[model samples]
Target: MAASSGRFESAKSIEERKEQTRIARAEVLRQAKANFEKEERWKELKRLRGEDTWMLPDVNEQIEQFSKAIAMAFSRKPT
Candidate 1:
């Protein structure tokens, strides 16, 4: 009977630990999502105010412009 009681106690402890871990992970995810939304809101506000928001340029466009500039520079032979 004592062995059965011990098993039951261990099972309960395991369940409690699992529940705690789940709660902690959920809280962390919630905080991360909130932070991301806040940042997006700030960017939107800046946009509405005609302020430049930091954003990455399109990689393909940048590459095309860079290639053109390099070609133009090379075409002009050193005087």
Candidate 2:
């Protein structure tokens, strides 16, 4: 009975560690995309108003893709 209890505790600890890693990774991705969006929007708005400037649509696409990836990762959690 004691051995079984120890094994159970070890397994529970591993599960918890995995959860923490997932949460941290998600937050990092969210922050990175947010920063990119802030800068991109400023440039895009300027370009839209016919300013003599340029914008990278590829960055916009990456922001969209990263957002989706974060959402999917969170959704897979064993709530």
Per-model CA lDDT versus the true structure: 0.85, 0.85
Q: Encode model 2's per-residue lDDT on 1-79: one tens digit a residue.
A: 7776663457789899999999999999999999999999988997788573344668767888999999999989696
Candidate 2: deviation at residue 24, Å? 0.2
Clash count for each candidate, listed in order shown = 0, 0
Instruction: Give the 10-residue window scoring lowest on summed lDDT in candidate 1.
Output: 52-61
Give candidates' CA RMSD values in order. 8.8, 17.1
**After superposition, candidate 2 runs with Cα above 4 Å error:** 1-9, 49-79
Candidate 1 wrong stretches, greater than 4 Å: 1-9, 53-79
Give per-residue CA lDDT, model 1, range 1-79, as digits (tens): 7776653457789899999999999999999999999999998998887576343557656887999999999899887
